[model samples]
Target: MTSPDSSAPLGVFDSGVGGLTVVRALRELLPNESIIYLGDTARVPYGSKSPDTIRRFSVEDTQFLVSHGVKAVVVACNTATAHALPVLQATFRVPIIGVLEPGVEATLAADSCERVGIIGTAGTIRSSAYQYALAMRKPDLQIHATATPLLVPFVEEGWTDHPALKSVLKEYLKPLLDKGMDTLVLGCTHYPLLIPVLKRMLGNKVRLVDSASTCAAHTQRMLEEKGLLRTVKSKPTLEIYLTDLAEQAEALAKRFLGTEFGKVKKATL
Candidate 1:
């Protein structure tokens, strides 16, 4: 039988430490719950992978979470959410949520069918996945997207605050700003690390819509609907796992999670 504490530890995964943003949001909203996070650091950028590859990687990631006894799984990568959510949910008995739908819904509520810019990794932009998703729901929206590969590596290198990053930010965001985008979707999970610079470059009118908070909201509501919110404990449990780069992963986690993870052990499934 599944333990009553089954829902206590919700699983969260990303291609890298960027998903810690999702974890941060979850902690604020679901304070007493337990969370299990996995970052596939060895394959740190899922954004450029083929759809088939992303699906397979997501399966392995979720399987790793299930092995840790989590009751829910959150696909915290936009690329994975764009391509792999269905298979992850189908294979797992527990609830599965992804970042894209929440982000899309957020985008839908933010602006009309005006120009919307999306900046992500080369794979995400190349996939044309976001454009397709929005087109189905809001066909009139003029979608413009770019592949900001440097942003990902710059972010990964912990250069979010560096002046070097600011220069790279301008180059990556110039086209989107030129397109007169009213709303910009940070379509890659790692892109949020660059949000501050992105906002500075795009100005107040360009609403930056990222998926972490909304994903947390959905996770919160789902837990409530299922009566899974932990009321007995005042603090939630936090369990972190990484596929590789145990030390660096923990170091990067500090920037995203805003606290020292101390140690992130390696795990395989």
Candidate 2:
């Protein structure tokens, strides 16, 4: 692959609109850089897919981004990051950033607690990706992981304050709370949308570690290190593509970005 010029837009891909949270962070931190975002909405909730399928989808997504001449790619989906990051990095020429490491680093940095909790889709929690990452960094850390699969659908439906949300939150978090976890890692990108409710439920005693901002910070540092940082003052453009046409995606994206995207085109991949 030819070297990507600094002017090339950064590529961000997720299984669905959840990745927009990462895009939101990127826009805030790297305002001058343009972005191309891809959402595989047709086969979303990748939390249930097998590793092989996830890897294949991730490869195709990366290929799509590379075809657009992006300087780097961000695997904004937690399941994809957990399953396919190494393969994507080894195969792709440009820098590929995954949400896992940044989230893990932030989780550890938040507090020096041996009892740490993690919540994500069933696939993410079952894969033990966060657990392994944390153990590698601190072998003594006790991991309490739970799969809050319903939260993803709740977030997708824009049910931030639905009457049923609190009940589910309590059910999913009580175990970790009982374990006396001082830090909790929102393992899935969709989980960040529930931050306010999560904070209210977890309270101030438990620190929440969100990967969105940390991942953006990591991307900025990496781009700077590689001399690929965009510094031009031109208005940064954001182009979004999704595998399926979803009206909800646009609305959810606005929720993440705090502004409506100029366009949301349907795509096949």
Candidate 3:
């Protein structure tokens, strides 16, 4: 229950390799801080799971990180954040953060963002977490939310530039675009990988609020507030763990984490 040392690595978890995007952002924003990342590939796509199951899985994920003596835990999965963030925070003494609120905050912070559209996994959109958070802050904000369940698989398959992906994206975004959405919130961690394609389709007018970068910024502020920012000047380390290491995990990790990708260990949880 005591305060974790600033030198301890920051913990981050996702249902799969998608959370590596958040890790990539954190590395850029807080270069001095080390990170411990866990990808629950064994139970990938928490989006379709029940709230109770997601919560239980999330608790186990947090416990795995806490066992490693992390300073703070970042729930990098939108589905888990939507369903289990409160319980994780209450159960664990370490400062816990989620991608949901940061994404909402980033969306509202966009200039001239009147009509906002949010896209995420089925669980995230179904939970209405981003919609509710945005509404709570700006009651009059026009919001359109939908679950783009197919996008995740496409991204994982490394088909970002495939013609089929374009077709699917067009289909998924039509309703939101028709609603005159000026800004779009990529609610899931996996969605950032689709940004280049999304921008190509939506153009410069529709601002994209990426949860990965927003969450990293939020984490930096929280660490500052709690005096948990690492003071060491040496090169920071990154430890990658996965519940089930898929054959393509390394390539996928590279795709998500960019230059920060490294050896991924198999985690029991």
Please report how far candidate 3 places residue 187 from its true position, in Å: 0.6
What is the descending TM-score order?
3, 2, 1
For candidate 1, the lDDT comes to: 0.82
Query: Residue-wise lDDT of candidate 2 within 1-269, one digit each (tens)?
Result: 46779988999999988898999999899889999999998888789888999999999999999998899999999999999999999999999999999999888875567799999887788878889999999998889999888998888777988779999888888999899989988988887888998887767898888989889999999999999998777888999998987777777878876677787887775
**Tens-digit per-residue lDDT, 11-115, candidate 1:** 999998899999988898877778889999888789878889988999999998988778788998888887888788778888888887788788898645388
- In candidate 2, which residue pairs get closer than 3 Å at backbone N, Cα or C atoms, i.e. clash? none
Best by TM-score: 3
Clashes of each: 0, 0, 0
Model 3, span 1-269: residue lDDT tens:
46789999999999988999999999889999999999999988799999999999999999999999999999999999999999998999999999998988888886598999999989999998888999999999999999999998899899999999999988989999999999999999998989999889889889999999999999999999999999988788999999898888777988899884667899997
Per-candidate TM-scores read: 0.91, 0.96, 0.97
Identify the leading candidate in terms of lDDT: 3
Question: Quick one: ranking by lDDT, best first?
Answer: 3, 2, 1
Please report how far candidate 2 places residue 233 from its true position, in Å.
3.1
| Decoy 3 TM-score against native | 0.97
Candidate 2 all-Cα RMSD: 1.2
Query: Model-by-model lDDT, in order?
Result: 0.82, 0.89, 0.92
RMSD to true structure for each model, in Å: 2.1, 1.2, 1.1
